[model samples]
Target: MVRRVVVVGIVLAVVLTPLMGWAQSKAVLPPIMPLRDIKPGMRGIGRTVIQGQKIEEFDIEIMGILQGGGDVIPVRHLILFRASGPVTDRSGGTAAGMSGSPLFINGKLIGALSAGYLWQPGKRELALGTPIEDMLTVLDLPNGTAQTPWPRTFAASEPFHIGRRAITRVVVTDTLAQAQRVDEAGLPGMTAFIPATFPVMVSGLSPRAMGFLRQALGAAQPLLQYDQEGATFVASPITGGSSVGILQVRGDVSYGGMCTVTLRVGDRLLICGHPWDQMGEVEYALTTSDIVTVVRTLQEPFKEGNLGDLIGKIDQDRGPAIRGVIGRMPRMLAVRVAVTDLDAGTRIEKGVQVVRRRDLAKTFAAAMALTAVDRARGQILGGGTASVKITLRAKGLPRVISRENVFYNSRDVALASLLDLPDALNFLLYNDLAPLDPVDMNIEISVTGKRQTAAIAETTVERREVAPGERLRVHMTLRPFQEQTVPSRVIEISIPRDFPRGPAVLVVGSAGRQVSLESAPEQGLAQLLQQEPQPSPAATLDGAIQLFEDYGKNTDILLQLIPFGLPPEGSEFVKFDVFAGEVVRTDWVVQGEIQIPILIR
Candidate 1:
């Protein structure tokens, strides 16, 4: 009886599997119009939200098709659309946030509302459309390549082209998101045509912090305004013509664009009528968003919205559009931050859910950590002593990359103490090898009211010369920060047994790396990050350990004894011009430089 009942239950479960209910989620792929079939003087209408979730239609007439593009993209085809009717009167012309709005002619689909001219002396009616054929090609494309075929191009006289492409700023840790800019030329005649890379609504960042973000990111990353409405960000669904975000950040700082969802086939979705970053075959986080309202400006109009839960991965970032997949969360690097305030006797611990991206992983993570520390302390860190311990773990590494550094600055110790981790991550992310397989990261920061900086007041040496294998002692006087206490220490070392019978120099100075200076090459730093050669994403974690070790610490006290002359003919010192001590790394900001001459016999 039990065997018969169990088999009957199994059969019932199998039979009911196909009957499970999924709420009505329609994929509106009306109908497609091929570029070859489109001609001038054709009439149509399109749908998009000028404000809120209300879908409205505007009249459109095809002026003609364009026939010229660039070198890499040989496809010379884009449909020109002229606007009229009530939609034209309300919006004046094409909007920056209306890139992927679908157009229908004769009750069928044509393509997305992509771009428009930057300068407009009168009514806005001219715009460009990326053929439905190309936008559809984004559905199932591969890395570094697109499947869109070169359609036949027709000759059209003086057809208005899309605006110049300007890089968009994107970050997904806690604070900001920015889309692309079409007005790259910045001509004097144009009012302010920011018709690309829709607004990146940011939350939780003050104006000052937003300014700091600009400083930290520099020019390669675009800047966007701060939005407070995204504080209640949650996830929804990815459907056709719905607002979607290629989320880079969540939590307190919502940084990602409010873009239009172009198409959906099965579990696959297409979005961002233009490229988000155009880093093909990417695995970026995708989430649903709700349009709040459109802020109209003389320069440009934008849509501000709140991002919803992360539910998918953006599989491709190509020219025509960004494509994504639902039902799977993207792989992310885990970040944990602990801030201890001694004065208040309070400790705050926070965890950041950072997206795992090649160009964004390190910078975004570091910004998140910095924001966490700043928030825990109730303000930006300034004029205080801080001890930071950073632990880095990866998949294949035998041990964690542990770094402990101290900071002493009159302005802000926050940046100095926590800089190494970010720089190291940057090196790892931008390595010529593979992506870094980061397991988890912990940054333990302790703060105190006392200042921890001193300058070398005086230096005294035991002797001007020394014999081989002799021990030498050096005394130094130090001046503390605005305080009466003057503390000093003695550093000692022994001359090499086979030292050359010649003069030498002893150089003593501040130890750790320079905080104001950039540790990376300037030329490459200004440009966009290129794709790395990777066997697997985590291929270079081990070598990155060496890079982290070499960047030096800010709180370190660096001391060195250099033999000024060439070593006696056969000594190992011949390979080097100077003998730097084994302890070259430090966390202390160097305050003084002193050179003393000595003789080695």
Candidate 2:
């Protein structure tokens, strides 16, 4: 049994909902013409913002309706229409960023402007829209069902820097425009209409950073417009047909999607007759938008708009429409990045606000760190070394997680310096021991335009045998890049006094190599060749924090003694246990490894 739902509100008289099949209330609201009553050739007007906050009108004619064939609308319905009017005449046709523009016929609301063709004839642009009944279905969804976002990970890849990259500006559209072939209403045979894509307006990122986003986002990368001066439009209260922004990242770096308001009932509003991120029941930051002008293009016309103040939060994203309230703000994580150019003696700081979703926050934080270093150094690619310092704070943690590392890369040193930040963030966000919320990350990077790296040439110890509780001096020879092997540096490693006397393995190498030696399990040749090194699972939040802190810097020479013996009791193999260890810091990034068999008496 299905009941028609009618909305009751003050601004307009509303009626008709056939999808949900619930009993109707006898309250007055904006009128909605049922899909059954709509017919071909019926004339109407649609509302959208062409410039500024003013909602303008465009003429529309009902062409046909696309019903359930599982082709257009699998569950609900789509109303096909052709758009024209003074506004359409000026802008050429229906543009992107007008996904939820409201349509009215005979003084009754019908649907919202959603999908359109890429190329349309003059004066008339054919489009499809979600019916008002379908759009209203979002209102019946269960509230407070937002789930914690899963952590995201992107493999580091080199950006294609072959040609000139376009500077991104302002506009929000769809990431994917679902293409459909329509054959009805005397339309140009088998015309394909795609849902209007929400192009996310972005600012402050360099060409390199934009390339990073493209690689990171892959096919779902939204159109990005670079704006030096951010959204500065005068504040305006949102209403039906007004422009709005779904801001994912803000502050120093602005990244958000824009769409038109379809309907407003009290404080609640329906928007974007399609999914923004397709993330249902999400809490994304919402904001008002001020349209500068409609960017009329031969390929696809779109609204060029700037994101305004953060005014509310969008709680639902569904196939029919996205829904939100006008006053409740969403939680945002704070990330501050500071970059210092050691050669130029200049520093730049950028503060960005990202949605509380750990995935977006972590990925964007790394990108921001790269951009900060690039902006400070005034270059994108170069051979250099960077000293990176990261401090992470969370609500439930007793103390902040702090770490520092030095990185060197022949190309894109700024990017190489940011490698482990996402892992650290993943540790905090994906840990089963604690729910880390209200996380704040601050990153500091100091860069020098020099490839400061050294490879281990030789390692020598005074004697291969040592008694318990005795200290031994191990000397290392480092081969610097394009230079002679430096004099051997001596490091002291103490042997722990114990009853067990046996053969021990002395490993001298970079921080990474030494850590692996300490944690490596006793395995057969096949297991050693097949299995990759993995971090030990932390049993507690404190343990996770300790693991994060224990990571050695790239500029560290590590010495460790691993006893060649049987596996520990209750364990399959000896793992992460060392008899003695010592860290020797160097000005250059250390590389390579050497192992020496020792007799412990």
Candidate 3:
């Protein structure tokens, strides 16, 4: 009987879920006043923030309804209105951050404050409201609906030059492209549709860190004048007119935008007077925030915000507004950075919950990790040797890559020490074998105040000629950083028995960097054809990791030697053009290209 009841319950749940969802989807929308019914003589009240976290009411009078393409609504209609009452008396004009302020007439919802003109002190404020009916259209969309022109990889993983290059071009939002979009909305000296800048609730950020973020994000940079934060962090809650943060990174380096809430219906929400990236299906952390204050200027007024607790994700960003679902937390990448100082016997470990993304992981990781190191050292500066080991834990990947690297930064030790892991991870994150789902990122960085590096200052060959099966010795003068030079040591190379009687040249340089190799060429055209662009399993995770290892790390020695009988062709490189592990990894970081001539007999 119990089994039957369980089976029947499952059957009913499966049968009734679609019915309930359909009924809900077809439900009547909230009371709304059509754009046609709105008149020039209509008077209404709107809600927004002018001072603090409070959502105060502002009086507005509809001046006219604009139907031209130049208007905010362009084709349909926009209720053009002017500000009045206490809001005007205090603020002097409609502010930029007041975009999402809801407007109502006769106790019925009309629209949200969407567009604004340049504000002048002691002048009546003019703005346009987006119809509420347009916002409700999102609620009826299919669950899997995606925003048009999806986000795709455009650039390689380089600072400010990665992701969706076909669109953004140079930066995440290229200055030229972004300026064009911003201009299309409205031109200065005329009433144009303006999207309010969402407040970014930031904390524990240094000027250097801020500069990095602005560089990465491009023209969408935050207006620092409205920032409200300090060394410590505070949690913001969900309230209309209050700020909500879309966090990209949290901890040493924090980045995110703070948007205002317009309305809430059950678990569904409407926020930000404008769109946030317009990424159709996205999972980004949404946190609550408080308006620290308002920064007023002739250009425009903006609201400063202090971030608070993470709420949920604002999923759908459309034309007029962004919709969010509360209580659904977005997935984040887990990171742990441990910085240890050898001399001081001190170590600090900071962890961050970063937005998991291939385009952003490397940059954000570097920023956050550097911040942690700087803060731990009281912002001191110096060059030092660093050893970095990284472990990447990912889902669906067959192997976890554990890569170790060493660097001696003669300039800034703290920053240089933090470089290898993030740089290496860039290739891993942007690998073509689908997107890597990184569950955890762990980095162990050990730093020493002293330099632990060496280079070959000079080289001398003991003998110019040698018989086959004989060992040839080459002496190298090793120079240590800021230390006494070590006496020359001999490196032996064996002449193979099969070598022809001829002369050969051996050129050695710092390995891994500018490294080239040679192999026997195909004797036949058919064999040579097979060497061309063949498909690579390098498209897989293991293959991608191997690719990263080969070109990413700066370690070992690369020696290009012309064996006795081989011809010195146009291009010395025997390019196999396949994913192969480093064929020549040296224990020491070798430098300089020393050429030595040898005669094989």
Candidate 4:
């Protein structure tokens, strides 16, 4: 009899298997349901809030369905009719923080607990819920296939317990039934639900700004590339005015943030114009976190749509055509190369050159030295030539003193003739440019000596042919002083017949001291004159006289000479006499002097 019973049971199970499979396949699952069906007297499951985790389920039911609708989508609301037990601890009825808890009815998804509207005082109101259907629609997942199904092995009872009461056995069928019943009554007001989480995208910003953000995020590599155009050759002004040449920007690597610059010619590059923003001149690096790249052609101006995307790799080399890169990796850099118009007769090409930052004044000094030599040669040769001199004064580098090949006629020389000149020898002496690189020196131009403070000055020298044994004489005059008696002096210098035509000093002396001299082909007479003494502020009469004498001894009086050439047959003599006035007061005195000289060779 037992064997017969077992056979019959097995046969029955086999017959029902196909039917059960068909039923399971045909059953379509509803995505969501309303919350109103949960009657105050009904029994259902609720979601228990967990810290740092998704909310779990609890036993609950709808008390009453709130009905309202407007132009917006209707929100089917349900009240947590009742709880099987204490729904929460100190947190308060799932507490004020328990909003967004996904509630389930029977075995199906129902709605999320929103908030409570107290109809009266004393009696606490139940929690209201927004239907899952409305939320899913707003999330653009109305079909409910956006995510995978919850694990069946996970205990639903754990989420739906009433204080130690594990009520995880709530079925989806019951949850949906309760929500559907609430919906039948009336939908709540038209209020769209905000999704718990979502993703978004944005664009459009300045390249500098974007590069800055990338650096802030601690990107490892450079996001943009920068290219350098070779130094541009600028012609000296010809229309009686100075013409500035193009200030070429060199290729350099920088991270996101402000970059500070000290321009060789700041005035020529407008801060607000193309290359830079409208920030005043500064020396330190400015903060710029955006990616900024050079674009060589219009077809490739932008690598990435946004600046923030590119930060590292800004210094990578692109084709010769592109000038900069501005963006993050994997994104192509937009190339931009702006060709500025060169002055009428100027041309530019690539060569070994250095960008001078602070040593320009030194360079100018070296150039001036060269110029003096050229002037001396010109005087002897009877004509001037175009020349260029460069001096590198910076320390740690070898002394660089270069003089361009002399151009006999300025008309035949092109501006390019001056390109690639070396730096000034004393250019590096100054650590930095003061007020714009102040240079203090006892400058001696031939026989004249003066203590001067200047920014920078350049000199060039050129040589021309002079008849053999012919003497070179230069005429020089002092620029008269408007306020003070010019502390100036001069000396005659003669070069030997075989001495190379380059920078050569004729004479050197201090103020007021007379240098008795004779003539020689290599050594010239140095005539140093003391200037007229001005009044002095001294306490006693004797002190005043002494002061005047001291001043006279220190002050220089310059002598102007004309028609520099070989000496003519005649007498050459220069004389000066001092005159003293009676002391007007015990502390003051007036003194003067006059110089009378005769020149003969």
Global fold similarity of model 2 (TM-score): 0.75
Q: Give per-model TM-scores.
A: 0.75, 0.75, 0.71, 0.20
lDDT of 1 by residue, 1-601 (tens): 0000001000000000001111226654657778878887899987665554456788999877665444554645566778778865676566556677777788777877766544455555666666778777778676677434233222343433334423121111111211122134343322121224443444455444465555556655555655444244323333445555565655555456556666667667766556655667667766655555554556444454555556677778776777877766777777777888776677877665566674455555555556666666677646677888888777655677777777665666555556555455654454545444777778898877677676666777888877877866787766666755455567676666765668777766665654451232222222322224323223355544653654345544445566675432222321222353423333234477677888776
Best-first order by lDDT = 2, 1, 3, 4
Top-TM-score structure, candidate number: 2
Which residue segments of model 3 deviate by more than 4 Å?
1-29, 49-54, 66-78, 148-193, 199-201, 223-243, 292-299, 421-423, 457-479, 482-507, 512-540, 547-552, 561-588, 595-601
Clashes of 1: 25
lDDT (CA) for every model shown? Answer: 0.56, 0.66, 0.54, 0.24
Q: Residues 129-186, candidate 4, lDDT per residue (tens digit)?
A: 5455444432222222222221111112112323343332211111223334433544
Candidate 3 residues 109-223, lDDT tens each? 7877765544234443766666777666654555578554311112211112112212111111222245345546553222223444443434444455545545554445442
- Top candidate when judged by lDDT against the true structure: 2
* Pairwise TM-score winner, candidates 1 and 3: 1
Order of candidates by TM-score, top first?
2, 1, 3, 4
| lDDT (C-alpha) at residue 31 in model 3 | 70
Per-candidate Cα RMSD to the true structure, in Å, reads: 11.0, 12.1, 13.5, 33.1
Model 1, residue 313: C-alpha shift (Å): 2.2
